[model samples]
Structure formats: C-alpha cells, structure tokens
Target: MRDVAQPAVAAPAYVVGSGRNATLSPGEIGSFLKFDPDGSGGLKPRVDVPTAQAVVDKDLSSTEAEPKDATFSFAGDAATVVPAVTGRTIDYQKTFAGLLDALGKQGDPTPPTTFTPPPVPPGGTRADPPPATGRAVNAVYTTTPPKVTTEALQAIGPATVIGEFQTTGFAADSGQNIKRVADQVNGATVKPGDTFSLNDFTGPREAAQGYVEAGIIEDGVPDRGVGGGISQFSTTLYNATYFAGLDEVEHKEHSYYISRYPAGREATVFDGVIDLKFRNDGTTPILIRTLWTPSSIKVQILGQKRYDVTSQTGNRTNPVPAGVKSLAGNPKCKPSKGVDGFTITDTRVLKDVKTGQTTSEPRTVRYNPEPQITC
Candidate 1:
C-alpha cells in the first residue's frame, strides 16, 4: 500500500475573562492533559485532576480579594454611611469540570493510517511542531459579601453624640502634629466589648508616618519630639471616654500639670511606653469623630446614650514646690516658670438612663512639680 499522511492535532487551551483583560490561559492554570496510545491505535486524552487543581489555585491567587465592611464618615455634626465592598473568588471545581466537559465534547482524534518512514537528509532537521491549539472556556467565580453592610449599620440606630470635648491654645507646630494624629483617629469605630488602643491604631509616630517635631515633655522637662502635641489629643479622647461612660482600659496622667488640661482628668501618651485605651462597654458600636482647627482639637463619641455622665474634680492636695533648673549653655534648653505639684481626684458620676441608677468612679492623679528652667 502507498504511504499515508496524518493531520496534525493541537492541544486544548482554556481562557478566563474577555477582551483586553484576558491574560489568563489554560497553560497558565496547569497541565491537565497527557496523551496515551489506545490499544486500537488512536490517542486517548487523560486529565490530571490534582495537578490541574493545584495550578488553578496558584494561578487564581492574584484574583482573590478580601471583603471590606461598611462604616460611617463624619463631617461636622452630620454622619454619612460608607458602602461595603464585595470580594471575588474563582470556583476551581466548577471551572475544571466545565473545561473537562468542553474538551470531551470535541472528541478524540482518529488514528493515522500506517505509513513507511521517510529518510532525512544529513545535518537536516524534521519540520517544526504545529502551533498550539485549544478551546477557551470562561472561569466561574463567586462573590463574598461584607459582614457589616450599610443597611445593617443604619438599622442599628442613629449616631447620637454621647460624649464630646475640645482643647485649644496650641502653637503652630504642635497644632500640626495634633491635626495629623486627629486625622488618623477620625471616624474610628469601636465595636461593643472591644477595646481601642491609640498605639495599636496609629502605629509608630515617626516622620515617615507624617508626624513632626513639636513641644513635648521629656523626663519632666520641656522638649521637642515627633508627635509631641498628640498628648493633647490623648487628653481630649480620655475626657470624651470618661463622659461617654466607656470603660477605661489603660491611661496615664501627665508627669506635670499643663494649665490647659483638667488637673486630675488629663491623660498623656508615649509610643511604645504610655498608651490611651478604652473599651466600648455598651451594646452598640461607638464612632469616634475628631475635628481640628488651627488652634483647637475636638473629639466626640457617637453611640447609644446609655448613661448620663458628669464629673466632679476635688481640691488639689499634697503640695510639692518646684525647684529651679539651669541649662544656660544648652542650645535645646527652654525656659519657663515653675508650677507647684499636687494630688487631685476626678469623680465620674454615671446615671443609667433606663434604670435611673447611679454609680461613682473616682480616679486620683499626682503631678511632679515642673521645675523652673533657665536657658
């Protein structure tokens, strides 16, 4: 019989997405098929399920995204809801099954007729392989919804101003630091029974994070450091937490009293050392809203009004006189008049709105006299 010729067959290929976005292909996902000779003389296609699945997982990883919950954005005294984002993930099993089914429908190739071999010329090569061929099957995907949807947040309740406090009279540099920290803290939400930490939320206070050198108390003396004026924010937040009837998890009083802050109620923070933390003790989530101006900063807590809170500051006691300090030759020295140190107590009286019950929490703070400095 005369020699017979066999037509070239192409491997199957799969693709996801469409148009310009269609960079994903079957070869990228995994090598799913291998050809084996049938006893009758034709080639049989077999799919490696495990290998294909592994490749699918590795290839689709970049396509996966985490869902984001909805939250509120506060401007002035009004609040607006931010919509949640839906996430997407590929359905590996469905995609693989669909691809396999598509390939099966194309059917196996017919066996080539028997033929006599042809001799190749010396130093010559056989013809180049045929170009790759395959069918492009679309991938299946599933969407993930956010846990806290905008509708759910709105159904909770209206954001009532439960606590609010404002502080003023900071210099320009200190004011910048204060505003930077305030921006980071603005519109934070604390879920019920969850504690919010200033350090944990804002991370490190470095220049890279947008904090600048400003006035700060270093070792009971006036100095300048990055994020110096943020303590004013801490003091303001502490007062807001106190008036909101939230549980104070951790807070520390300033080493020396600043005239602008409430004597016994003020708080100070140092990164990695001192921190301002508070727990949302109520049933509903609380939103922290911060606002700042050129000379002032304000913090407000918005949530259910569970308690009517008030403060009573007692008289200062245990007076300690400030001593004089001379830093005549030091370029970094800052001069100031000394102030007497004393101990004082701030009592928070909480009255339950529903039960009409009342409770008192007393917090005492001691200040170390600020020494008079001479540069």
Candidate 2:
C-alpha cells in the first residue's frame, strides 16, 4: 500500500490558463492527504480539504484574469471590430472534490485480471505486462464570459452615421479641455434602452484628470475655472443625440448663448451638480466617436439608422439689453464685450423610415444677458 501510494505522492497536478498548456503546479497530489488510524486499527489515507484549498489559493489565485468586451475602432469612415477576451478563475471547491476522488483511487489496490492470455506459438516469446502509471487530479477552472462578444456585436449589423455635430472657434486652453472631455466620451457604446450620462462616465473633471483652467460661466458671468470648455463637448453630444432621435433623459442649457453654438440647442454640464444624459431608444446599440483638431471638435453617433431627423430654430425674441460693470482695480477682471440675451425655441422633426410616419418635438430655452466688463 505504501509503495503504490509513493508514486501517487510525487505525481504533479496542474492548473492552466485558457488555450494554454498547463504550466502552474499546485504542488504534489499527495500534499492534500494524511494517514489516520481507521476504526478497525488499520491506517487509511484521507484528503484534507483545507490543505487542498491552501495549495490552490497559493498557486492558482494569481492566474485569474478579467474578461474584456468586444468593441469597435474607427479609422476615417471605416470601423473595425476588436475581439473579446475570455477570463479565468480557479474553482476551489470543485478542485478539492477532484483531489479527494483521485486520492481514493490512488490508495486502492488494482483488481486481479479474469481473462487468460493467448497461448504463444512454438519458439515464440511471451510479451511482458505494461508498467503501471499513476494518475493525478487536475485542478478545475471556471470561465467568465464577456458581456459583449464579437458575434453579438457583428449581429447588430453594419454601423451607419445616424447623428453628427461639430463645434469650433475655441482658444488653446479651452480646446485642450474640450479634447480631454472628448477623449473620455469617444468609443462609448450605449446598449438598447440604456441611458448614458456624461458626468457619470467621465467622473470628476479636475486637474488630476488633465483638465485645465479656461473660460466658463459662473453665476451668469465669464470666469476662469478648471474644465471650462467641457460644455462644448456636452453641447456637441447633445446635438448628436437630438439628430439620432434618442430620448433625452436630462439636459440643461447654458446660462448665456455663445455665438459659436446654436442659440437654443446647446447644453452645459457641471460635475455632480449638472449632467447631460440620453437614452438609446433604438433596437441596436449606438457607438459614440469623437474627432478633434486644434480649434474644433466633432462628435458622431453611429448605429442602425431608424429615423430621418431635421431641426428648425425660431427667431430670438424678448431681448434684454446688457448691463455694464467696472472692475478697473480687480486683478481677476477679464474685459469682454456685452451681448443681449433672448428666448428661442428649437424643434426636432423625426420621420420614421419603416412606416413613413413623422413626429415633431420642440424645446424652448432662455438665456441671460452678458454683463459688460470694464477693466
């Protein structure tokens, strides 16, 4: 019994990653076994679950990997699919059970053969019995599947440019902030019936996240603050969502209108305080892609086309004249020209391609007058 168990004691058990050969050894198979006296006064080998689990934790824990979902990469007008990766984790309970079963067989004696060997011909030598080989338990592994697979992404069909918008004419610092926010928003995929929030996705936009101090509106006045130009990204994304015929969950317009953006169709976002969000109402997933230049930024929404969308803006009305403020001695004062504020309405028209049905949705926005700064 000892001799039979000796070979099994030194047998190596393996834990392996997916699609790879077994390279990690969870020590010897007999490390989980202990000799104890049976009730009949005979020694018996038993498996220690804790010892087996310890060996797995030490050797197999490090082999775990996180799964990655498939995504799209765009170049110019073309998009390519990036394959998903499978994740691996050790199954401690299952592995311990396998070790215990293998140990039981290792301690058992081989049964006698019942069949007789064939008679050898005259002057022919008989063949010797084959050498016995010990078997070891292989550690079990569990696989975690990625949420988005390549086939699943491909089944959504080829992507079409459903909505696109661009905004330009920004200073260097402001352009940097715009680009930073754009980088965070690019390549985002919104599944069907799922809502995407700009603030939630980008988190806090502070200096640590590469945002710089630029121009912004504070209490209806121009001021310098971190992540100032992020509103341009929010406005761009908002317009794209508008053209995509998606559901606008939440959005807030700027306090004052900037000539660079449409009067009543722009959006602003402040971390935690304000957010820009939209829901994917279509049946397929939508992918957001961003492109930026030195003084300009563009956002594009790509997915299956479901609507033909158009927009109309009403004439600005209820104009309010600007007021003047003198800040000659203030070091933080930045001189700027005053602009009149007004109210305007913007309408989005959507025509369903499948049914040839049309729907019109209108939104009204009001802006505060910009105060003249005298320095």
Candidate 3:
C-alpha cells in the first residue's frame, strides 16, 4: 500500500452571481439536481450528478431571470410610474452539460469552473428609481404612452365630450348671434388651475364683431341688442361647464325665466357688464366645443374624467300663474312675455368615485313673469 495513489475528487459545488452578487447556497442548489435530464456526472472520482446539476441550476436561475414591468397611475395633479423589479433564470440543459464537462475534468485540487453566462433578455423598461428626494416621476417605456402623460397632453387632440347642453328654439338673427358666440367659444382650451371667460374669449359684441341685432331678455322685458341671442350660448356653456364640475367665478340668472332654459342653472352674458366665468380647478386641462344648427345651439366641455356631477332642481315657487300679455301702439317698446314668476334652486353634487370624496354647489334664481306684449 505504500506506493498506491488516490484518485482525484471534484469540488462539491460552484458559486454563481446574481443582481449585486447575490449567492445561492449549495443546499438550495442541491434541491434542483433531480430535474436534470442528463445523468449527473460520468466520472467515478468526480462530483455526483445531482451536486453538479445543482450548481449549474442555481447559477443559471440567478443570472437569467427577467424583471417585472412598470405601470402608471394618476393621483390628483401628480402623474407617477410605479417602479419595477429585475429577474433571472438560466438555460437548464446547456448549463447542466457544461457542469458535466467540468465534473469530468476535476482533479485533487479542484479549481472553480464557469460557463459563459446566458444572453440577457432584451432591455425592458422598469419604473426608474425614485428621485433622490424620493418623489415619483412620470416615465414610460413605449412610443405610444399613456393618454394622461404630459407629453401626450401637450398636443391636446380632439376632445371627448364630458358635459353637454342643447336648445332647438331660436330666431334667425338671434341664431346668428348664437352661432357667432359659439364659434368664439369653440376650440377654446383651459389650462389646469386657470379660468375661462365668455366675454374675454368672445371679445366685445358689436356690429364689427359680427353680432347682429337679436331679441334679448333685458330688465324682465324682451329687447333688441347687438349680441342679444348670445345669452343662449352663455346659458348652454354654463350648464356644460357646471356639469363638468368647474367652479363658477361669476354667473347670473335671467331676470325672467325662459321656458327653454334649465331653470336656475342658466347664465346670461352682456359683453363687459355681464360675463360667464368659470375656473378649471382640475388636475388636467379642458376643452370647449360648440355646435350651432339652423335652429339649435349646443355647448359641451371636454377633459379627463375625475368627478361625477349630478344636478337636482327644487320645485318652482311663487307662480304668478298668468302666461303672456299683448301690448299695442308702441313700435319701439320692447315686448314682455307673461310667464309665471317663480323661484327655484339647483344643487350640483360632485363625487370623486376613485377617492370617495364629494362636494356640493347650489344656486337659487328668482324670475319675474314678463307679461307678453306685442310691438
């Protein structure tokens, strides 16, 4: 026995690298060996089949796993991307084959062995790391990003109707004014946290502004004014924006109730003296759309949906009861329509379905019955 030489033995296991050098223990690697298709090891003096496979599997799993992808979220005014994670897993059969090759070549002083790492999966985007200040950022992975993104919003494409109102009764000249005013308000864009004004956008109503003489309600009587019929446009816009959950900066009800309007929710604009104003107290921008037919005027608002608004109108009170009066002999005198006088209030409630939040706004209007008169 003095001259006999002992056979060489392979190392029990090998170390593998992962994200930031995370190590897999031999015990964990040992569990995966039975799944190897090829018998563990071929040489009698080398590491066993299970041990060799365990080493390979652990290394492959560590370096080849794929990461989870990122996603977007909107909370109030801030747009954010939730961060993603990285994952890895190796090619089982090939890596295991490499391990078999290493086991066959093992010797008394077994040196560490390595196989070429598997190719990385295509570079996928995960949410970027939180900013140094730990604030969320709006970053995305694809060319077609989320619709609510700032870049996507910058172009502001055709809007989706969020709220709308329409009326089908109009006189020709009044209809012209309605069309002209609606044209002025159409395509108007309101930035986040900004205010929109009917008078400002429509400019002064004069002959030069294309305003024609139309019948308008003035001091409880129907009078002719250059921008007379524009009140219908104002009323339409008021209801649209009102339902869209905007804040009314200034609005006034008509002195006399017009049967066509939605009770107390209407507004009247008289160039500089009276104007319809509302604030876009929202996290995103909004668009105004106006449409006018031969006998109809419609107004609509467009923006990202946030709040759900519903309106309720109280029953009419103080009905003067009479309905129209006829007056003669005064050609220049304005006519009065004797509709019943009444008082009513409208309540608009806004509910934030996402956050379970709510707010309410109310408006009360009193209309004096304008005795119908003939010129």
Best by lDDT: 2
Q: What is the lDDT of candidate 1?
A: 0.73
Tens digits of lDDT, candidate 1, 230-271: 889999999998998999999998888989998888888988
Which digits, one per residue and each the tens of the lDDT, describe model 2 over residues 1-375? 654356445444443322222321324455666778888988876667776666556645655567767777768656667777666666666655545444434332433222222564422222322322233344455778776676556655777678999988888999999989898877678889999999999999999999999987664446899998898889999999899889989999988788989888999999999999999998988888889999889898988889999998999899998898787877767788888889999999999989999999999998988888888
With a 3 Å backbone cut-off (N, CA, C), the pairs that clash in candidate 1 are 13-134
Show pairs that collide, candidate 2.
none
TM-score of 2: 0.66
Q: What lDDT, from 0 to 1, does candidate 3 have?
A: 0.61
lDDT of model 2 at residue 349? 93
In order, what lDDT does every prediction score? Answer: 0.73, 0.74, 0.61
Residue 89 CA error for candidate 3 (Å)? 61
Predictions: Cα RMSD each: 14.2, 11.6, 22.4
